[model samples]
Target: MKKLTRLEKYHMNKVSQRSNGKVVAITPEAMEIEQRAIEREKRGHYRVAARLWLQCMDVASGEVERARIAIRRQQCITWSNHTRQGEYSGIGCRGVVYD
Candidate 1:
């Protein structure tokens, strides 16, 4: 089992509190997939990470909190596709055009 980060633990605690004390434990397999997704993101494999995040969202059913995850996954996909197509130039990157 991977150790949860303080942020992760804090999020879990918030979820539990929001759910009126119902513990929302993620399955080990889901945890493994999420870890892999994080690794992919760290490696600059944004598309793969986005797909893995979608898989994680699927596994995390029955909650409105999953909406946040879905939005983030969509953002990853959008950014990854834009970057792959050479259409994205934001804040600090090279070739950014400020208006």
Candidate 2:
């Protein structure tokens, strides 16, 4: 699993702080959109999920929703990098020997 970066942790902490000590229900429209995006992603529709996620960011009205987007976005970036690197090259050792 990819480890969370310091920035990611900071962002998460900020979001948690903004929750105001209560749970809020998202609007049906927003929930529908987010759910659709997740379903599309499960069906291998990456671009659709990506676009929906961006839309969610635009429509999100509260800190909780905004934080969800930020966290998911960061996770996507981390996963993308990890997958891409593994596909292109295997991890190798780096060291110097005295000549």
Clashes of 1: 0
Give the alpha carbon lDDT tens digit for every residue of 1-99 in model 1.
Answer: 578899987765465323432222265555667778877877888899899878887787445446555665776787787665545667776875887
The Cα local distance difference test for each model comes to 0.66, 0.59
Each prediction's TM-score against the native?
A: 0.51, 0.49
Question: What's the TM for model 2?
Answer: 0.49
Segments in model 2 whose C-alpha atoms lie over 4 Å from true places: 1-25, 77-99
RMSD of each: 10.9, 13.4
- What would the per-residue lDDT of candidate 2 be over residues 1-99, giving only the tens digit for each residue? 567799976654465533543222254566667777777667756665667767776777666666776565555545445443333233453554333
lDDT of 1: 0.66
